[model samples]
Target: MNLYVRSANGYRVASVDEVVSAAKRAINRKYRRGQAFTSPKVVEDYLRVKLSYEDNEKFVALWLDGRHRLIAYEELFQGTIDGTSVYPRVVVQKAIAHNAAAVIVAHPHPSGVAEPSAADENITRRLKQALELVDIRLLDHIVVGKQCVSLAARGLL
Candidate 1:
């Protein structure tokens, strides 16, 4: 639940949120720009670190080059606790701007549920179809909650 982290003064107890933030910073430092993402675990860990539980929904995307190297990471949408709007046009535009050849999209559930709902599947379908027109690959759509569920792994994408 809670852990201790070293600080300038001494070791101090850090909340889950603080630990997640620190992990995210460390990951960002460790995996600099242009590093290829070769493993799905890295994506899962990065998502867990970046999008912890909150009262609202936040949709994020990881932009990757043709070789699966990192280009940029962004939180594109925010909404209430239950649902959020995902615009495929926005995702397409941003991918074009980054010149990304692939993308991994994810969002956290405030209720701490990792199951991909029907809407999630529909959006994934639309996103895949939209991105295909531009020759951009949709790597996966992950649902982050108590645990991560990958739609790609489930053959839903």
Candidate 2:
């Protein structure tokens, strides 16, 4: 399927093909540079482009192993805007199911502000603690918008 993005800036058509292309470009750039992704926006951008063709509200989590490297990235949930929910227990369960050693969670702010809200902070703290109990590190909680913020880099996680 093809994806479309509409904003005050304008409308643009993005297909799954384009998304994969963009992600590959991003990954190659990072790999060539020998650096880890430093921002959540980068990851979000990859997912957004990759999933742009789909029609649903989705949240994705990127699971990492002990070395802070990507083990897997998957969509954790999907629903309409008014009533989507995320449970910490489910998150922990998924992490355990994946045998993830660490995690960097991310969700998009369609409104385009990367600021972490009080609720967002609280959730991150709760998830971090939960994961810690199982020896799975919460490496970061990233808020993606037109920009992105890393709670770990900001010392919030």
Q: Report the lDDT tens digits of candidate 1 across residue range 1-157.
A: 5599888999889987787777778989977789888888888888877776567988999999989999988999998998999999999999999999999999998899889999999999999999999999999999999899999999987
Residue 41 error for model 2, in Å?
A: 8.5
RMSD of each predicted structure? 2.0, 7.4
| Per-residue accuracy of model 2 over 40-67 as CA lDDT, tens digit each | 6555555455443434445567777665
Query: Number of clashing residue pairs in every model?
Result: 0, 0
Range of the 10 consecutive residues with the lowest summed lDDT in candidate 1: 46-55
Off by over 4 Å in 1: 5-11
- Model 1, C-alpha of 138: deviation from truth (Å): 0.4
Error of 2 at 81 (Å): 4.3
Clashes of 1: 0
- Could you give me the TM-score of model 2 versus the true structure? 0.67
